[model samples]
Target: MSWGFWRNWSIGTRMACIAMLPVVLLFASFMGYSWYSHRIQVDEELAERGRVLARALAETSEYNVISGNLSDLRLTIRGLVQSDASIYRVDIVDSSGHGLASVVSETALAPQRLQYGAPIRKQVIWINLFSDNGTPHITAPSDIRPPTVTTTNVGEVRVTMSPTYLLGKQARRFRVELAIAALALAASGVLAFLLARSLAVPLQEAIHALRAIRGGNYKVKLPVSTGGEVGDLQASIGDMAIALNLSKQDLENKVAERTRDLLASRNEALRADADKRKLIQKVNSIVEDERKSIAIEIHDELNASLIAARLESQSIAALAGKLNAATPAPEIEEIRLKAQAITKLTLDLYASGRRLVRRLRPEVLEMLGLHGAVEEMLRHYDSGSGCSFTFHSEGDFSRLGHDLAISAYRIVQEALSNVMKHAHAAHAQVSLVLQDDVLRIAVADDGAGFDPVLSSEGIGIIGMRERVYALAGTMAVHSTPGAGTEVGIVLPLEDRVNVS
Candidate 1:
């Protein structure tokens, strides 16, 4: 595995592994070095002991060799081998490197044996005085002329000792060393565990505290101490939490303040709208009453007088007709023609008065319903303006209440007036529909339409829009230069409360 894989392990596990690995390797190296040193020491010690034993054997066999006693030399060599358990063999050789006597131990020879040799030298004794009396003397022998000295190599002593005993002692020492190594490994394991816990516990606590903060539990507080980097990190996180909380509270306060201000503005706007509607309704009601009064006065008084004048002219014409005959005088014929002219003028005056009365207030609006009143107005426009109008109505308007009915009627009246006066449309269409508790009205014309934005300068559209808004309704005017005009309105039927 790579370092990434090791990183996935818990801090405790990684730390323990890191700490124990080196200690284990050190102990292994120490054990290897100890074994090598023991082997060398054991071999050297065994070889030294073999050399000492070989020298002793060579000295004892020297006299036997000088006397030429081979039996005694063999007996001595066998006795040495039997004395030492680690000795595998013993040998005595003459000066020519020929073995004169040898002995082998009963024990099996070891693969690794210690062998050593020592040389034997011949010795001579010389007498310098004759033994005449114990008191006297000092006399030189005639044979000692040049101090006769003789030295000769008599034989060699070779000893072979098995290294198994030394090896056995080394094994025992190694067992003790192995025990110490095992104890050291165990101590290292315990120390690693302790070190890992000390490091990992603080980090784990910090991690848990951070997790709590992420979960939105900012109330958590970590203990701070002289723990180095981990401790400092925890303190920084705590400070950040405090900052976040403050920011959150400040933002919430700002939002609440903004919401309250918006609500107050909305309430003010609603009140102003309600006041406007009330004023428009009052004005409209006054205008309607004045028009009704004017129409009643003209229909009752002016039309009656015009009718009386026409009757008087007709009576005069009848009288003039009876007196007039076959050419008579020029004055009488002129009088008759004048009387006829008076009768025609009176009839024209009566017709003009009636037309004016109808213009001021249509009595048919009260007699019939809204639908019939609208139809009558369309007919009047058709006759007067030479324009064709298509009208469609649906749903019952009897229960629509007077305020709404009058409002809808006035809107249509203004729209048509605009069409006749400005539009010069050859054809217009008005539609009234009631569906799903809503009343929809549309007045459209195919004419030389003006831009609605510019046309708002005129009184017609403004009046229609005012009426619609007073009724708590919405209107949209669609018109462009040379494209046609269409005015659409939608009014909620449920909003038709009685107008005060």
Candidate 2:
């Protein structure tokens, strides 16, 4: 097919052009070297043959009787000349410069130079021989030039030859070699381009597929109109796209379902949270109402009854005192002991009621601030137990909100109770500090600690957790089997700390 101007000058052409450039330089070298080398080789062979003939002729002892027998010399020279195909003739001339015998055709003694393709010009060999005192010297025939040789006492021999046939054969061979080189070079260029395209095009297609995938077009398929490594790469890209598409579809479906499920679950969770808060508030109200009633009843009715018993004891003692001395000493002693026992029972009952009231609602928490209340509680604990507990506080306690105060007191109270019940602690440290807009409350005990994991279900721990959670505060209970228990809480005291 004929190539278009632009098409002829495509990548292949450029490649072919580039490929041809080296070949052209090599071909030029081949041309110069081949011609020079062939000519030199041919001349060397021809000159060598001529030297052999001259040696053969000289070796013949044609003595001074040469005036009689020129025939033997002529025959010997002719025999040597006839051995080579390129040698067309051999002639011996006597020292007097007269031709004795001619082995070459008279006309063939002079031939023309061989031309390559310029009209099958004659291919020739011209020869000249020199003799000095019956010794012969031979030089080969040459077309372009010849060497000057003088003789002494011997004859001159001239031979003509034709190398036209050999030249013709070489010409044909050179033409064949040229054609083969051209075809081989052109074929190699084409093959190289195809190889390059094979790799480059697939890489390009793979890149495009990747771009498409990046652009959210996961369905884009890589082209597979290829074979070998490129085809494998395309197939791999196809697999990747398929996987990406599946993953994208899966994510999309899950996202949709998750969105729906989250909405429904959130609604239910909201309702549950509201119900739970309501339930908790109701329980708190009921418990607080009951506590108030119980506190009032114990202080009024029960405590008044104890006071009445005490008054009765006093009256009995007065009567006993009035009776005095020897009137039924046993009966009087009995009355006195009875009065003393009544007074002791009433005091114990009042103290017991006060303990119950504090447990139910630490009234001191409201009356005194956290520090004072905690101090009082520690004093009670210290009196009851032989353990020394230290309390430290900072910031204005009165500025704390009511709810925060209660929760903090409760958490501290619960923590202390845990220490007393579970810790078997020797001593405890309660440090309350205000730092960075948050109150950090820490209760560390040097005691035989309990396992926090096992203790988590304990009521005191549960209550502490609930209180902290309600206030959006954090509580960390650190305890090891042997080391000790530290209950710490960081509460945001951003309440009405700036109270009027």
Candidate 3:
């Protein structure tokens, strides 16, 4: 009845209706067209038949008209009417508009009857006789030609034909056409219903599985092999369900492992006070390893997934841009805006994840060695921190082992973090110098310095000192209330270098 009603219909019903409606309409139109076309053709044929009958009557009545024999003319007309049932009436009129002979049928005229007229012309017969010398001479027969040079029109003959037979035949054909159309429509409906059912059954099953998944049942699956969009969707959903189930299991296992590790660590802490330094270092190493793992996970999985989502959103935006939307439907523009916003948000999320991973562990530290890594860090801070940092280095830190290089990098990083968090200064500098057997580095910030005697060292400063000590190095903190703070470290190069 309406589009809304159709929308409420089940998929099977809708599909059946959609499939059969066009077929039924086509069959009906074809039947009507066939009937109308046949009727037009039949009418044309009947008119032609009437015209031919009138012409023949006019030709046969020529002698009757010349002889003024009304009886014979009437008999000819009656004979013609008797010959063809459709010939309802015939009339012969002289040139003076006087009717000489007429014959009428007992049948009543049809609603739309055929009438035709033909003019009667006197026909001349020329007799050719052989002369005595075998030459030809022509003679005309009597008053029909009267030695005239051309034919003469004597009168007009009119014939009227009833179209009752044509109508009857057309009615019979229409009935046949109706019967055929009905049969075809019935067959098409049956076929459409079967096809729709075939599609809908599998599709309904897939839909049920989707609903189960929505209800948090990841075990639900559909093995429908329709080999179409539905099939692809089914496969994708099944894969997603399995993947989600695995992830859920993995997460639960991880939580249990972490709980056990926490209990073990608590016990170890209570049992070992003399090995506090070793425990602290071990904890630091564990934390660093976990950070690296987390960063890798974020980079590998989260970042990739976000980037993919962003690209998909961008593709959607591009497609939307290409669409013709001179006059969009309701909510179309809103949807377009939402798509663009989603793309933007996805991009933001990807950038943020990358920044997080970079902060957790600088990949450049592994790629370009310690010198390049420290320089890159300073450059990044100089650009982002609103404070100018000048870095100066002497000798190659790249020659150091990973542990030594990483310790140096961490000290510098901690010093910078202190500057950024506590320093109310605009200028900072970092120095890495290798002189003789010792490696020296200092990070100094021109800030409102705190009196080292009265101020307590922050965790960052303590951590840096511990790192320097763990490397068997000495660290110095120099600061005054008015002047800037300088954090410096010195390490012997013997233990850090490997000859091989």
**How would you encode candidate 1's per-residue C-alpha lDDT over 431-484 as one tens digit per residue?**
988777788999999999987566555777788878878778899988888878
TM for candidate 3 is 0.43
In candidate 1, which residue ranges exceed 4 Å CA deviation?
Answer: 1-230, 250-258, 302-359, 380-389, 417-429, 435-438, 444-465, 474-488, 492-500
* TM-score for each model: 0.52, 0.63, 0.43
- In candidate 1, clashing pairs total 0
Candidate 1 residue 258 Cα shift, in angstroms, is 4.7
lDDT of 2: 0.70
The window of 10 residues in a row where model 1 has the poorest summed lDDT is 139-148
Mind giving the per-residue lDDT tens digits that candidate 3 earns over 107-204? 53662444699999986765536544787744446424333345789999988777777777788988998897899899999999998998888888
In candidate 2, which residue ranges exceed 4 Å CA deviation? Answer: 1-183, 207-221, 224-247, 270-278, 324-326, 434-437, 450-457, 493-500
> For residue 264, what is the lDDT in candidate 2?
96
**Candidate 3 segments whose C-alpha is farther than 4 A from its true place:** 1-274, 322-327, 384-386, 498-500
Clashing pairs in 1: none
- How well does model 1 score by local distance difference test? 0.81
Cα lDDT for residue 321, candidate 3: 58
Among these predictions, the greatest TM-score belongs to: 2
Report, for every candidate in turn, its global Cα lDDT versus the true structure.
Answer: 0.81, 0.70, 0.80
Q: What local lDDT does model 1 show for residue 4?
A: 79
